[model samples]
Structure formats: structure tokens, C-alpha cells
Target: MSLPTTTKEYFWKELGSLANLSFRESKLPPLKSHEVLVKIHAVSLQYRDLVIGLGQYPANVRDQLVACSDMAGEVILAGKDAGSEWKPGDRVSANFCADHIAGETTLEIQQTAHGGPIHGVLTQYKSFRPHSLVRIPEHLSYEEASTLPCAALTAYNALMGPVPVKSGDTVLILGTGGVSIHGLQFALASGAKVIVTSSSDEKLKIATKLGAQHVINYNKTPEWQEKILEITGGRGVDHILDVVGALDQTLKAIRIGGWIHTIGFLNGTAADVSLGNLMKVCYIRGVNIGSVAQFKDMNRLLASHPEVTRPVVDKVFAFEETLQAYNYLQSQAHVGKVVIKVV
Candidate 1:
């Protein structure tokens, strides 16, 4: 738990690329009264990290910002005030937006997001305030815990926050990415019927094994909405976790008064918001990554029910292969979260 004089870290040194990222040795800063130093063991890859690396994300990050948001590690050092709350060797996960500890997210809170508008935890060691870290569940390994901060938390917010999915209700999750897979798990745990859409029939089979009640191959069935309505006996699903953000299709898939939780834009970001389409649903909630309070709540659930709530890590790269991990995520071949092992 002793501090090192210098730590190795990766940074986004230029815009519009991830090809030439280089590691630099930096001296550790003195810990503040409210801070603890983390020896990051693992960091998970998120799509937003890709955009931030390209300098296309909206957050006003530093010129050479560290390039990731989700990380899990040991609390290696704790300052005076933090000592009571955190101790050396405690496993912890970093919050996505450090200042958004609880309550609703705001523009100011969004700017404090890690990996963008702030230095991230893709380093051997990083320091953070107690409020910005959550102790991970004992059952989860550092790699598994690393997957929660962004993808899992967003999925939890979509399913459990704002409008909770109820038993006997049908929930639709688009694609087999990290968030969508987690959504499928939460929906099934809530006793709701799950319908997952994927372009790959193989991935669809995997989704079925993960407890998705129905699977749609959107590539073969161009009009997946029709299939969804058919599956529900023309009633449509009660909740839709639309990670792809297929606007027209999302508008078509929900039933009257059903909730559509828009979590990501893997398909596309911009779409013409048709007023007619908007009127069809009761709510179209936009889900951010979620607050630290939500992350703690999720960890509690994961602790109690490890079978249903654990993270599904698709692949792990060595810390030196961080760039390749991002490339793999870009290929969209991963079924769940991709991680970088930094221990």
C-alpha cells in the first residue's frame, strides 16, 4: 500500500486518433484530507471513451487527459478524513461522474465526468475523493467490478430508476452489447419477459442462454417492430431499453403508455424527433451513466444476487495493449464488456 514516486499512465495526447497513445511517468501528488489513492487493477472500455479519445465528445477535457471512466482497484492510500471510510486493500470502483454522487444529473455534474473534462483512472495509481469511489462487492473480482461504473449503472438506471419494470411486463433490449446484456438480466430478475435483438444469430443464442425470453435477428427481420408486436400478441412491450437508439424502430416498438429508456446511440445520435412518434409513448427517458448512489445500490443487489447481477466481461487486454482493447470495442464483436488489466 506504500506510494511509488512515479506512476505509469496512458493519455490521449492528440485529437482524432488512438493509434499513438504513449505512456508517461508522472510524480504522485499529495493526497488531500478527503482523498484516497487507488492502485487501479482493471479498467473497462466504454464507447464514450472512444469518442473522448477522438476529441469529439462534448466534455471539455484537458489536452492530455487519461482516457477511461470505469476502473476497479485497491485503496492504496487514504488521507486523514478518508481513513475512517476507506483503508488500504479495500476493493473499490471509480464513479463515472465524480461530483454526481446522488440525485439528478445536471450540466455542471456532466462536466465533472471522468475520462472527459477530467483525468481518468487508466493509470497505475490515481487519487480520488471518498465520495467518488464505491467499495465493490466481495464476490466480484476487480475485472468484473470494473465493468459496472458506466455500462451496468446506465442499464440499472434505465430499468430501475424513473420507471421500474414490473412483473409480467415485457422488456425489450436492443443488441448484445454490455448495457443491453445487463438490461436483459435486470428485466429477467424483475420477473419481466425479455426480448433481445441482435444481428448475429450466434449472439442471439447466447442471449437466450442469459435468460432472454425471445430473440430477434434484426438483420434478417428488417421490421423487428412487427416481430415484437407479434410476440406480444399485438400489445407491444411495456419497457424498451434502446441502446442502439434506432429512432423510427424505437417509436414503433413500444405500446401505448409504455416507457422507452434511451441509454445510448450505438446506431446513431441525431434523429428527427417526430411529434407523432413522441405522442405514442408515455415516456422517453434519457439515461446517463448514473450517480454513485445508484452504483452503490447496484453493488448491493449484485452482492445479494450474484447470479443475476454480475458483469459479463467479454475480453481482457494487458495494460500495454490498451489501444487494441479500444480497437476491439470499435469492431463491435464483443458480446459484453471489454476490460484492460492494469494490475
Candidate 2:
């Protein structure tokens, strides 16, 4: 198949609002050796995408940058020296940090993160280093697989990263957003008893249907940590995915020596860390998504449980409805992922 000479994409011409986003056709450059051209099939919205648009994200974005990070696409062409790893019609997703193939993330790796410091995969076509892309699971659609680049992988690293959650452990997920919901699924798949918290009982009900063993309505029960203790027979949970940045309460509900993977700060960044809470000997670590190796590992699990582990897509919008999709994500009404069908 012949590659297109130009591709349509959305760009953040200026930051501070979704209105700054503009669409236009961009010249598709020829692929270099070791690069593969992808025809992006879908793009998923992340909270960071909104943060970048609002100029609230703690990174420097380039002028007129392509918007968003997560995407699932097909390799439409491979450069001469790209090897046989990628070819026409190969389903793939790029790692969030393109350069960080494995091991610990560094300042250099952080700069390579898409949507902020670098151009993202929101375009109809883009060239990628073959090493940076991973073959997605056969069971997932482009929309479902698009969500994996960031949200799903973050949750996987939270649960299965250093000090992995295991069978018989108890995991407390803070909200029903993309990462938290994926955490719920991963925790359940690991045979761990899962508890999920949300301000909306309606969202909590959806969490229940998604296999959360215990659900907490934080609006009704402000001191939900105490309730977590009661539910866990006064032992507290083994691991906590602190998506809400509610450290004070999370520390209260964490088991002694438990792990709290600090994933997001939806509420705010400031947290009160008391000495009493510190004495619990619990470990609080920040998760910055995962590596290419880890992403591949997560895909292996997704492939194995194809029937049960599909991503929860809240809604899919057409490519022309990109602004509406961003608005929907900003409203925080969606349960899981908000996707855009680029095809």
C-alpha cells in the first residue's frame, strides 16, 4: 500500500484552553531507517492531555504541538533498515516514554514523554522508531488498545510493579477513572480482594459490576478509611492506588508495611503527612507509568484473559468530535476511557 503524503491532526496552537486546539493537514515526512509509519486508528484522552491544554502540566510543551499521548494504530510502512519486526497492517501502540525501553526513568527519558515535551500520536499518520512500539493484544479494538499506552499501563505498574500485588492481598483503588478502574481489574486478576472509592455512588455501582469487592462513597462517608478497616476485619488493605492524592486518609487505611502507589493528584497535590501516619512503616512510591518491557508484560496478561480483561470504554467520539471528547473528559463524568476514533 502507498503511504499518504500528508496527514490530518489536531494541534495545540496555544495553551490554556481546549479552544486553542486547531486542526489542519500536516506534511507526512518520509520514514528514516529504523522508523515505521503508523496510521493511527484511535486516540484516547488522558487527564494530562487536559492539563497540557490548560498549561497546568508541569512540563514544557513545544509550540503548535500535536495533542494527546495514547494511541493504537497500524504500521502502514517500514523503512528499509527497519527490519521485519513491523510491517503493513501490524496493530501497535507506542510506549508513553518512547526512549525508556526498560529500567528506571531518568530526566532524559522524561523529556521523551509524548503530548507534553514531545509531539504526540494524535495525527492520522506518524513515524515511530520500531523499538518504541509494541504489538497490541488481538482481542482489543483500536479504541480499547489506545487506552493502554498510559492509563492501563500506569495501573499495571501500580499493582504489578516493584512489590507486586499477589493472590489473597487486598487492594484499595481510589476512583473509577481510567487508571483506577484498570487497577481494579488488575488487582482482581491477581486474585486480590479489591475496594474502590468514589464520591458518586452511581460510579461505585459501576465499580461493583466491574468486580470491586467493596465500594466506598466518600461523599457519604468522609472518614472512609475507618470503613475500610471495618471491611478488612480491622487489618486494612495491603496495597493502595492513591489516585486522588488523599494521603492522610490513605495512610489511615493502609495496612502496616503496606504499599501505596501514588499515581495521580486529581483532588490536589498538597497532602498532610502526620508522624503517626509515618510510623505505620508503609511504603509510598510515585508511579510514572511503566517501561516498554512492562507494557509488553501487561499486554501478555491482556492477551491471556481476552474474554475478561477488555478495557472499559466509557464513550467513543468521531475524529471530528475531538473537542467534545476533551470536554467530556474534563467534566469527569466518564467511568473509564474516553476515546476518539481516528479512522
**Using lDDT as the measure, which candidate wins?**
2
How well is each residue in 34-62 modelled by candidate 2, as lDDT tens digits? 79999999999999999899888776898
lDDT of each: 0.87, 0.91
Lowest lDDT block of 10, candidate 1: 264-273
For model 2, the stretches where C-alpha displacement exceeds 4 angstroms are none
What's model 2's overall lDDT? 0.91
TM-scores across all candidates? Answer: 0.96, 0.98
Q: lDDT tens digits, residues 1-343, model 1?
A: 4567778999877868877566888988877778998899999999888877776676577778887999999988898887588898899998899999899999999888888888888999999988889999999999999999999999999999877888999999998988998898888888899999999999999899989989999999999999998999988889999888786787777888988899765656565568866767567888998998999998877777789767889999999898899999989999989999995
Model 1 CA lDDT for position 303: 79
Against the true structure, whose TM-score is highest?
2
Clashes of 1: 0
